[model samples]
Target: MELKEKLNILADSAKYDASCSSSGSMRKGEIGSAHISGICHSFSADGRCISLLKILLTNVCIFDCKYCLNRRSNNIKRAMFTPEEICTITLNFYKRNYIEGLFLSSGIIKSPDYTMEQIIKTVELLRYKYHFGGYIHAKAIPGANMYLLKKLGSLVDRMSANVELPTEDGLKLLAPDKSSDKVSKIMQYVKNSQNKNFVPAGQSTQMIIGASRETDLDIMQKAEDMYQNYKLKRVFYSAYIPVNQDKCLPSLITPPLKRENRLYETDWLLRYYGFKVSDLLDDDNPNLNILVDPKASWALKHLDEFPKEINKASYQDLLRVPGIGVKSAKRIIKSRQYFRLEFKDLKRMGVVLKRSKYFITCNGKFDLNKEFLKKEFIEANLVLGEKANSSSNIYQLELFHE
Candidate 1:
């Protein structure tokens, strides 16, 4: 097959994996601006990444995962590229300024080990034969042997092990062949290689939201475990789109966006706002609060903890208040050390007094209606501020991607 034909098939197949980013790999004016933040050239029509030349090594899988579109039973077009072809395509794209790097994933062909080896060869060809220094992200197949991961890690910029589903039971129901424990173990192996300089960009994984029967709490717990255990760079959540029918999964038009937003909110809390998964969710609250963002929901539920003295509040203390974010809280911390802040001083510091005022005290005074009559207190109150905002949170993520 021609190289372009191979590119079309490979790129079409790889779209299923969402673990990607060109962030954190900074160079001092060498490889452009270093994207110290990150660079997503554009988002796709479906709101997915189109920055890198993302594609699969092949769509022909030996294993059959029921929820997947590329499974053996799905009867989709199949194509595979040789190592030289992949390396040549990547070099050509990079030279033409068409892409920053490559993102390669694949269906399980022959066996996990065999699929992984082909992936490793493509990247190795890029780095060695073609001398390509551009970024590369590859899949670390779950049950594939770990030694391959170790060698391939040094050749690629980042690697990911797709979690596929949230829970083991969810995995059993949708992808009976997948083992969550085995998958997590591969993540752990990748993580351990950090000191060896195996994968400096760090590992990431993906979870298909609203698929199967797993609750938000269940999904976030796994995310927390991945971050805490594997030190993963990210855990991407793709709101499941029903491209196929299954008796076991939901047949919704789109995965719940609000729930996805809620999870994003909850995820922000876990990574930046000093929250335990147990804090935001419990037996009573099986799913995240659909009405309020998780952070706002938690603050309201623990009302007694609020109305804190912003003038004297520590950095950690300010972050706990409903509306205070890392940036605003830092301003409060720095500004207060110099002067006793009044309500107006907070506004000057760019702190949203409307939301912050209720959760905080300026000179020992709280400004909030005892009735607090906004219909959805979190939105009308928190977002729309009493007003609106997490800088080390979601906005950070959007900026990180942009």
Candidate 2:
């Protein structure tokens, strides 16, 4: 087939992998060209954000991963770009200012080593032959040779080996060919090899949510372990998009976008808010409350700890508040040194007063007028257009966009 045909097929094929941030919009019109056709945005080593030409080396697979569109059993159109062809396309795209980098991933073509070699060759051509100095994020094949990984790491700006599912049982049931141990070993290799010359932007991994019977708590526990063990830069959660008919998978038409968002919120809490996985949920409540964010849920659950004086609270305490972000928390710490903060001052400092007011106090006085029962508070928060509502707005926003 022609290169353009391959590009179209492979680009569409690449969309299923959610390892990078995607501006989920299809802005195709008589105007500018920002349509979501495999063009994705990623951050650079120096924090300069750039768009990447996200595509797959091939969509032909050896292993039959049941959830994947390009599984061996799936009768989908397949395409593979030669390394030279990929380099030429990347260079041409770069010259036209279409993208600043490339994000390359591939299905196992013949073997993991062969696939890795093809990926490496493409990167090599881009770097040496084309003299392309742009960012490249490459996926390391799970059981590929260590030397190929080292070479790929040397060439790419960021490297990731996706932990496709959350738990071992999930992996065994859904992707029996993929070993979690192999993926972990690759992660450890990248973590150990990270230095000035290798993978400067660090390593990240993607996890498929709701793919199996893994609860939100189970996912978070796995995420925490990955962070602590592999020292990953980020654990991206891709809500399971049902594409094939399988007995093992959930029978859902829509992706669990809300659940995915909640997981992200919990991830933010764990990474920045100093929240442990155990602190977010227990055995009784294995899932996150979709109506409210994890932070607000935590605050509501531990009401006795609240009405915390903003002026006296530590940085960690400030982060635990429903609406206080890292920036606002830092601002509060710096601004409180100058004067005693009121609720208005908190608002001025970027704290969301509607949600925080129930859990915080200003100048030793409660801003909450009446005693709100937990049920009432949750209901009030869930009401549309109320300032207390943030998570539910996601559903409205998705509807508006759709």
Candidate 3:
């Protein structure tokens, strides 16, 4: 087949593997379709999701991981593009103002080592041979030889290996052919390259949510480890959309988007809000609280910890308050020294007191819950847009965008 025809076949094939940060309801991604979440997020001189000419180098594999459509044993049509062909496509796309670079991934063509070699060659040809320096995002095959990984590390702007599933058991059941250990080792290897922060952009990985019996706790534990140990920029969670659901996978009931959103919120708390994984989950309660954001839930569960004075509170203590985010807490430290803060100043400082009020005290007074008996009443009174109501009540709120 011709290069564009093979490109079409392979790009269509690459969209189903869900390690990407896809947002739109895209059924497939070809050249003209531009909004894939995991590609080269650069813009043209014209601003668009036109950074990377994202495509697969090939769709032929030698391993039959059951969750993957391109698994070796699956009786699907196959295709491969050479390094020269890929260079031609990326250069053509770049010249036409279609993309800034290329995002390349592939199935295991012969062995992990051979596949890694081919993927690396494609990026190196674009970078060295063609003097193309835009941006390249490569997916390093987890079990590929280490030498190839070190070489590819220096060539691309970013790299990833899909964690595929949250738990070892889930991986064993769904993608029985891939290894969590091998994937983790690669993440660590990439992290080790950041001594002088040489690999400045850092690394990221994706986990498949709702694929197995693992809870949000399970996913977050691994995510925490990846952040602490591997120093990953982000650990993406792809909702399991059941492309190849066998009886072994979980029941396909609801769209996994809600659970996916919950995970993203939890991840946000861990990275920015100083939350520990145990703060969200425990040995008894293994799942995240679906009713509130993880921070709010943590605050509600530990009510004895509340009504903290905004004036006397430490930075670490301020972070523990439900509605006070990192940005808001920092602002309070600076602004409060100039004046004794009132209920109005907290709002001006961008604290969402509808969610934050029950947990904090202004000059040692709690208007929202003076009695402090009805946790149910407090929970019920809290509506999402209560801050925007502009009504006069104890729950009247004030906040700003920072």
Candidate 1 residue spans exceeding 4 A from truth? 26-35, 367-402
**Between candidates 1 and 2, the lDDT winner:** 2
Q: Which regions of candidate 2 fall more than 4 Å away from where they truly are?
A: 21-50, 370-375, 382-402
Residue pairs in steric clash, candidate 1?
307-359, 383-387, 383-388, 384-387, 385-388
What are the TM-scores, per candidate, against the unseen true structure?
0.87, 0.88, 0.82
lDDT of 3 by residue, 146-196 (tens): 999998887766788888787888888878788888998899899888542
- Candidates 1 and 3 compared: the better one by lDDT is 1
Ranking by lDDT: 2, 1, 3
Please state every model's RMSD to the true fold in angstroms: 5.4, 6.6, 8.0
Every candidate's lDDT: 0.75, 0.81, 0.74
What is the lDDT, from 0 to 100, of the residue 70 in candidate 1? Answer: 78
